[model samples]
Target: MNPRVIGTVRSHLVSRDQCPKYGDTSMPPVWIELAPDFEPAATDLQVGDAILVLTWMHKGDQAVLRCHPQGNRKLPMRGIFSTRSPDRPTPIGLHAVRILGREGLRLKVHPLEVIDGTPVIDIKPDNATLQGTAEFSSLVNPDTGQAILSAARDGWLRGLFAGFNGNVSMRQGERVVITATGSAKGHLGPRDLAVVDLATGTPLTSVRASSELAVHLEVYRNQPLARAIVHTHPPKLLALSLRGEGPLLDLPLFEGRVFADKLTRVPAHRPGTPELGQAVGVASRDFEAVFMDNHGLVCRGETMTQALGLSEELESLAGIAMRR
Candidate 1:
């Protein structure tokens, strides 16, 4: 069987040596100029859509079957298929990228490390239909999944961060429904959420849980009354934090007086680490809201709505304090 090229990559990197071994969120945008005939195949794609881009790595060596990982000569060589090395018998390159925009048949995407003029093979939406190893538990009901999506989008609309920088979760007995790791919170879909067992921190769904799952689990374990958690980086709050303002109790609003009783500040700890999770968990025993130094905020409540409301209230108060 022969595969035909449908497009050519337009990138500043002219050689494979100039490309990153793996692309990250900060990489510059590159254009995929598809053939005019393929316009119909890409018409449905829109900005912010997650997609998989298939390309032919023309510079790869088909005869090389094994190589050291990441060019680390100190490490042992492994089969090319076992690693992400571009060189292989087929030399097919797969990249998970977000559609930055589209002008006619030229689609702009981010974090793609392919060289200039590479042959584009196919494009597919990175949606929930992709299967995984997770065996979902019975606790992830429809309502729970929808609630998590709603909260994630709400937090995203609230301008918490520029991208998928926060996480939201709701407890269901021994398991919790959480936003998937690296998922664009503002554009979350059914596949962007995960169900994980709280006791063992193991996923019960096809997707992996947020990296901050440890922090959520700790809060649930420490606060029996807490049923939901919302973690976000409010711009105003982060600004205040940079100005050495660690507490939000200075506001003159009525909600400030109420939240102050349940508000506390925790020293900054590296995110997604056990230390951060422990510090937030200890603070959760008394404070419904936690101000993490140099980080953001973590709010817990008896319901998802309450937790989200508390986060909104605190952010509003921060905005007020900033103006004052």
Candidate 2:
């Protein structure tokens, strides 16, 4: 069966080898050249939005069912289904990219690692996962929303979030105001925050809670000291994880070596998965700061401001330690 191509990827990358295993901040902006027939679909998309781009990797080997992960021969061979290997019976490429700009029939997105000329099957808004939305309230808290908006602005200013990539949650008694899923972290307001019950991870606000809500709830249940949580994509900290120095950042700098705690590096897990959330929740029980391998950072604090500060401090320490 032939799937109609709705769009095409126009990226600088020519092959899978040139792209990172996981697309991140380092990737160049890529354009989705939609066919004029499909231009109407562009009306719903906007700049600063995160959309899931489904594509057909025309260059992959569909006949090869199993291989080493990421072309590394040393790693044991595994079925293609277990890994995100593009080579499979159906070589569909999935990318969660942030919209940078929109034109009549074109959209510029970031962190899309597919090669140029790849066929795009479809695009859809990734506002929030429906896995846990049934328990949330549709109403929002004006006060909590305002505070998180301020914090999200600070995160954007510090380059901790690439678009609406990161999330923040502030606990108020038994409830927490979490940044709503898929909302722009830089422009968050009360409307963009979800009030949730810490015990059940159920949202009391109308907007759905962030995809990482499970981990946030786990922190509250496991760590009494964790009154607030800040999850951000600090480039330096992410880089450290990529280089294998994140688990023990024993840098030469006095402050870097002595002040920071040993970061807990959680193994790579599919983001937003229950397993991933459980791993983070378990890790946060012992470590105040956790680094998600190949992904981002999770920091807890006694207050919202303190949690925000931990994100900045973690980035600073990562920068200093790596420089030494």
Candidate 3:
């Protein structure tokens, strides 16, 4: 029996030679345009969900039974079943991707290396094997983790973090859910985050914790009321710091003063070091936000919303300060 084609991939890749051996985060965005009759099947899918997309590689060489791995001529020839060659008898392509967005019948996904116009045979939720690299802890709240992800995306879209220069975390009792090192804040997937012990900073999952985990742990140690933290390199703040601005809280407007009364200034120390963490942590005890010399800003709040809001407020205030 023949499988029905429910959708077709819209990608920049036009041929097998243009595709990478394996899909990765560096690949461009791809759209799976489902037929009108098949749109109902995708109603349960949401942005940020991990999914497995099965595509029929129409351009593949179905006659080939064996080939070199990844088309490398030097590698020993392997049977089609033993390799991920697109020239298999079935020529079915399985891609593990994250849903970036959904617009009507078109779903935009990332890291899909399939050729343009490839027929999509099926779509399903990613299993544990797909996300095995990062083991999520049962003790950590999923809702809180999603919130942290939202905050990270917001910060990236707001130009708070340049590249992957910042990290976000939330305290949940004795554990902290945090973004993994080098994770793209705006395009985070399930495996891009991890949970760690709050006191010892030991990661609970196989995924490694952020390099600045020390700072988050120290802040939690000093501020018992803080449940969330946001660290970002806001452009305006960084520029002002470079100009030798004395205090980030010294704003011209009265509302700015009131909005940031608890903002404090911390001396510069090597980032990701215990000294820097200690300095920020001590300052966060009395202040809601800290401006580090030659560094960036760190803010804490009762929730991630509050923490992100405080960081945004400081960035806006910094922009105002720069205009003067």
Separate clash counts for every candidate: 0, 5, 0
Lowest lDDT block of 10, candidate 3: 130-139
- TM-score for each candidate, following the candidate numbering: 0.57, 0.54, 0.59
The superposed Cα distance between candidate 3 and the true structure at residue 305, in angstroms, equals 0.5
* Pairs of residues clashing in candidate 1: none
lDDT order, best first, reads 3, 1, 2
Off by over 4 Å in 2: 1-143, 245-248
1-324, model 2: which lDDT tens digit per residue? Answer: 547899999989887778777777876798999999876667646555557899998888889989999889999999999988888899888887767777778899888888889999999765443234321122222344455777889988998998878898877657777888898988764456676777777765467889888778877887889877889989987777677643546666666654466357788888888777888888888888888877788888887787888788779887876777
Q: Which regions of candidate 1 deviate over 4 angstroms? A: 1-139
What clash pairs does model 3 have? none
The CA lDDT of each predicted structure is 0.82, 0.77, 0.84
Query: Candidate 1, residues 1-324: lDDT per residue as tens digits?
Result: 337999999998998778888886677899999998888787656555567899999888889999999888999999998999988889999997767777889889887999999999999866533444231223354566677778888888888645979899988757778888998888877777787777888876677888998899999999999899999988888787788754555766787788777779899899999999999999999899998988898999998899998888888878878887
Global local distance difference test of model 1: 0.82
Query: How many angstroms is residue 226 displaced in model 3 relative to the true structure, after the best TM-score fit?
Result: 0.7
Candidate 3 lDDT for residue 30: 92
Q: Over the stretch 182-297, how does candidate 3's per-residue lDDT look in tens digits?
A: 88899876677787877788776777778888889999999998999999988898888888657665776887878679788888898889999999999988999988778888
